[model samples]
Target: MCSGADEKGGEQVAGRAGGMAALPAGLAAAPGNAAEARARYFNSANAFNIHLDPVPAHIFTAPAAAALGPEGAVTGYFLCDQSARLGCPWPATTPFMLARYARIAPGARLAADFAASGSIWYVIAGKGRVYGAGAGAGAGAGAGAGAGAGAGAGAGAGAGAGADAGVAEESALAWSRGDVFYLPAGASMLHADGPDAAVLWLVTDEPLLAYHGLRSARPDDAAVHFKAGDIAAEIERIHRSVPDAGTSGLAVVFSSEAMQARRNLMPALTLSLNTLPPGCAQSPHRHNSAALTLIVAGADCHSRVDGETCAWSDWATLVTPAGAPHSHHNEGPRRADFLIVQDGGLYYEARTMGFEFLGG
Candidate 1:
C-alpha cells in the first residue's frame, strides 16, 4: 500500500505564518492525516483532480512583439482578474487594467494628462523624467473619488515647504533606468524621454474604480516613483538574513502600502524584486494572493505554476493565480532577477490568506 505522503523539500513564507491548509473546497481535508490525503490527491495516478477556482496573476514576454503605436512604443497587455470570479465592473473587484509597454521616442514626452485611478510605471530601459504637480489634477484627466487621490494633494502640499516655497507651486522628478514610479489618483503628469528611447512598463488599478462608479479612467495618475537600487545589496541582505532551508532565492518587497505612515503611494498593490543564484531554484509554495512576475534582468530561469511550465526569457511576464503552488529555477550561470507585483496587502489585511510549503 503506497500511501504517498510525507514529502519534504522546502519550507513556506508569506506575509502571514504557515499552518495547515483548508481542503480545496468540496474535498475532504484530513485535519489529523495530511499525508494520507496528499497521497490520494497529489501523487496517485488514479487520484481525482479537483481544479482550483481561479488565480489572479499574468506574465508577458517579448512585449516588443506587440503591435507598435505611431510613436513606436509596444503597448502590450497583461491582465489580472483578482479572484478569477469577479470582474472590474463591480466595486468589489481589484482590476489591474490598461497595462502598457510604452516606448517613448528620444526627447519626446507623453502628453500630460490626468486620471481617476492610481497607477505604477517602471522604467525598463533608456532614460526619462516625470513632470507633474498637485494642481494639475484639476485640469487633466485626474478627478473624482479614486484610490490614492488624497496622497497627491499631500505631496503637493509637502513640496511647498522648501525655501523656494512661494515659487514651489509645481515640480518635476527625473528618473533613469530601473526606477519604479507611482502616480496617485487625481494628479497630472507627462512622461519626458531622455537622450535615448525609453521602454516603460505600466500597471494601473482603474477598472475597479470604473466598476464602482468612475468609468472614464485615463493614463496619467498620481503616486510616488520608487527607483530600484542595485540588486547586489538586496541579494547580500538575503544571504545574511534568510536561512538556507526555505525558498532557494532572495527577495525584497518594495511596497508603498507597507510604508503607510508617510503618505503611502499605493493602497493595495505591492511590488518586489527577487533573485535566484546560478543553478539554484526556489522551493515551491502556495498562498492566497496572486502575483504578476516580470523577468526584468535575467533569462536563466523558467517558472512552473501548478503543473504547467513556461520557457521564459528576458522581458517575459507570468501571472500566478491565487493559491497555485509555483517556483522558478535559475538554469543559467548568472543570477535571475525579476519583478513581482501583487495584491497580497488586501489579503493580509482581511486575514483571509494562508501560506504553505510544497516540495519543488
Candidate 2:
C-alpha cells in the first residue's frame, strides 16, 4: 500500500491487522501464535518521533524555606519533585537528576541511602560532619577525596585540611556552610549536624539510573569535600583573574583526582559554583543539559529563563530545562552565588552538549 496522509496531516499506516494499524501494510502481520502476539512494530512516521513532556523550568521556594526554617524543624528531606510535570514515574527535578533539601536539627543525624551512581551535596547553612565508608578520614577543598585522601593525607593535612588521625579510616569528614561534596555509588552516609541546625541542598542522578533499569556497581571511592574557606579563597582568586568581558562567568568547577581527567563530579554529573557580580548579568545562553541550581546568596536577583522571570530566593532550588535560553541577573548590592549541578558530563561524553551563547 502507498503511504498517505490522514485527516490530521500525519502519515497514515496502511494495514490494520486485528486493529493493529500502527505498522505499514507490507510489514503488518496478524498474530499467528502466542510468540507472534508479543511482537509489535511501527513505521517511521509514528515510532521514530516520540515526544515526552519537556521538563519544566521551575523554582522551588517552599521546600527551601521549610528546610531553612527554625532550629526545631524536623530532620527530613524536602524533595523538589517534578515527576508529575515531566510525565516521569520516579521523582525527578530534571529528567535525569533528583534535587532535594535536607534539614538536620542540632546534633541530629540522618542516614542517606540513595541508589544513585553518585551524589552531589552543598551546605546551605550551619555546620556538620559526614560519617560513612565514602567519607575520607580527612579531606579539604580543592583536593582529591577519593583514593587520593588515603595517599596524600599526610602531606596535605594542615590548616583548612584538618588532621583527624583519631577518626576511623572509613568515617567522619567535617563540613561547614558553603562547602560542597560528592560521594560515589553505595556510599550510605550519616550526616550529623553540629550545635546548630543544618540545611543542605543535594542532587543525584537516581532518576537516570532508574529510567535505565540499572543499579550502580559497588563503588570504592571515598567522598570528596570542598571546604567553605578554600572555596572562598579560590573564588577571590578567580574574581581577580577574570576579565570584565570576553569570558564565561567566574564559576568554580569541582572535580576529584579520579575524575580530574574529565573535570566533572561524576561520570554523568557536572558541579559548579556560579557567581553574578553586583549589578551584572550573565549573557543569555542555552545548553542541552538541564541544570539544578541552589541559590545561596541572591538577595535581589532573578533569572530570565526562556523569557520568563524567575525571582531568586535564598537556598531555593531552581531548574533550567534543557535548551532554555536563560540569564542570571544580580540587582542587589552584593554578588549572587549559586551552586549548579548539570548532567552535562553525560552529554559531554556523548559529544552532544550543545552550549551556545545567544546574541542580543
Candidate 3:
C-alpha cells in the first residue's frame, strides 16, 4: 500500500531503503562512519520506521551488566522512563519511569519497593518468586507466613475496614515470559529468583521509593499467584477458535487468565495476542492511546512508525505513543506472536467523541 507523494504530488520514495533518501535537508550529519551517517539520515527522516535488520548479534547472549550502548543509554534499546537516576528521589512524583535489565542468580531473592505511580513487570528470561498480597489483601494489610496471626489481631476491628486494607495490600502477582504484571499505586511487593537464574525487565514510574523503605509495611508471607503455561496450549486454543487462522493478523478479545488479570489493574488496558503469518503485511493504522507491544515468539518481524521500519525480534518491546500512526509487517519466514497492550477505554472514549483511523 503506497501513499501518494508530498502536497505537490511529486514522486516520493517507497520502501525502507528508498525512504532513507528523503531525509530532511541539513540533518544528515552523523557522529561516525558512512554507515552511521546513513543510519542517522534514516533515523531523522523516518524516526518511526527505522528498522535494524538481522537483529544485532550481541543482544541475546550478552550479559545484563554489560553496556549495550553509549553511557546512560542502551544501544538499540529504548528505555521508557529515561530521566530517572539511580538512588535519587524521583524527579516527579506523578509518573516517573525507569527500566533496568537485571539478572538474578539461581535461588537468589531480590526485593523491590512499590512505586508511588505504580509499576509493570515483564519477564524477559528465566523464572522467579513474586511476593505480594493474597487475593483479599488491602492497602496497609500485613502479609507473610504469619498473615493469619496478623489478621487475628485486627479481627475485632470493623469488618469493612479490615477487608479494605487487605485488598489494598495484595498487589504482587506472578509473571513469566509474555506475562505483564502490574502493581497498583501504594502497594509494596517483592520477587525471589526462580529455580533457574532469571532476567527481568523491570519498569516503573517511581524509582526512588524502593522495597527496603517499605519493609515495615510488608506482610510476613510470600505468594506465587499466576502462571501462563506452554505455548502449545495457547496455540491450541487459538486454532480451535479459528480453524482457518493461518494468516498473519491480530486477534483481539481472545480470552486468557493473564489477560483478565491485566484488565483488572488497568480497566482501560486492552490485552491481546497477535499471530503474524509469514510474509503478511499489516497496513498502517493508529491508536488514539498509548500502547505497549511485546514479541513473544518468532523473529525478524518488522514494524514501521510513520515511515521508519525495523525488525523486532522475540522479547523485544515496541512502544507506540498515543495517536501516532504505525504499522507492522512480517519480514521473516515463520509465524510471529506478539502481546499487545493498549488503552481500550481511551479508544472507546475517543471514538465516541469522533476520532478516525487513517489507513496508510
Q: Cα RMSD (Å) per model?
A: 14.6, 8.5, 16.2
Can you give the TM-score per candidate against the true fold? 0.63, 0.82, 0.52
lDDT (Cα, 0-100) at 265 in candidate 3 = 31
- Write the candidate numbers in order of decreasing TM-score: 2, 1, 3
Off by over 4 Å in 1: 1-58, 67-98, 111-117, 133-170, 214-222, 230-232, 240-249, 256-265
Query: Which is the winner by lDDT between candidate 1 and candidate 2?
Result: 2
Q: How many backbone clashes does candidate 1 have?
A: 18
The sequence of per-residue lDDT tens digits that candidate 1 reaches over residues 1-360 is: 123223343333221223223332233465467755544333222235535334343455445334122344422232222333543332212244334455556654442222434567777777755544332223332222222211211112112112222222235556778887766554343444555566666655554455455633334433465655654466577868856665535776665543565222455566677887888878888888766677776655788887788666666557777788898888998888887766665576777768778874
Cα lDDT of model 2 by residue, 100-159, tens digit: 877777765555556688688888888877655467644222221231111111212111
- Rank the models by lDDT, top first: 2, 1, 3
Question: Least lDDT summed over 10 consecutive residues: which range in candidate 2?
Answer: 147-156
Candidate 3 regions off by >4 Å? 1-79, 83-102, 116-118, 135-180, 186-189, 202-226, 230-235, 242-248, 252-265, 347-357
lDDT of 3 by residue, 1-360 (tens): 246355455565454336654655344455477765655333444657544221111122232333122232221212333223223343221122234444444544333333333445556666644443332233235322211101111212111112222333234354565454554443332333455545555444333343224222223322223345644466656766754433334553333343354342333344456777788777566655545566667667777765566567656556555556677788788888766655554356455412344565
Evaluate all candidate structures by whole-model CA lDDT and list the values in order.
Answer: 0.53, 0.76, 0.44
lDDT of 2: 0.76
